[model samples]
Target: MLPFAIGALRAIVEMLGLCLLGMGAMALLAGAGRQGNPVYRLFELITRAPRQLVARLLPGRERPLLAGVLCFLLLFLLWLALAAWRAALA
Candidate 1:
């Protein structure tokens, strides 16, 4: 059980790190004005799908910074939820 908890914590940390790295990459691309590039479009399709969906449901034009931050928060929340579920199951 202890090992399992440690593994879960490690996975959560790694996920959060990846999310931060991805957010940084997105910001760099946005800053470089490459948002229209095919690679960026593919990235948006793969990574930012949920943000895009939510933006469509909301009013006003999409803001990359805001969307990225929200996505990071959502990912963090997902990690927390997973950790909690694991703990409960244990």
Candidate 2:
């Protein structure tokens, strides 16, 4: 059960990281008009939670791209920690 929970968490973190990557790509492709693109909006919506969390840690400014990158790194660290825990359980 513990291993299963860790795996689930790892999956979630991995997914969020992917979403952030996709969001960044979309932003690049869509330019300043990304807000009007559905795909971009979807990625943005999915990554919003992590960005908001990072925003609180950052303090000042509306730097979404920077927040997204920081969020991705944080999620990657979390995923690595969960993997290590799961390996120990195994």
State which candidate has the highest lDDT.
2
lDDT of 2 by residue, 3-85 (tens): 88899989999999998888888878888998898988888888887789898898765886678788899999999999999
After TM-score superposition, the amount by which residue 23's alpha carbon in candidate 2 deviates from its true location, in angstroms, is 0.5
lDDT of 1 by residue, 1-90 (tens): 765875677586555547556657866757777566665566555555666654565566557566656666766777777677776767
Worst 10 residues of 1 by lDDT: 12-21
Hey, what RMSD does candidate 1 come out at? Answer: 5.1
The C-alpha lDDT values of all candidates are 0.63, 0.86
Task: Give the Cα-based TM-score of candidate 1 against the true structure.
Answer: 0.55
Q: How much is 73 displaced in model 1, in angstroms?
A: 0.4
Query: Which parts of model 2 are misplaced by more than 4 Å?
Result: none
What total of clashing residue pairs does each candidate reach? Answer: 0, 0
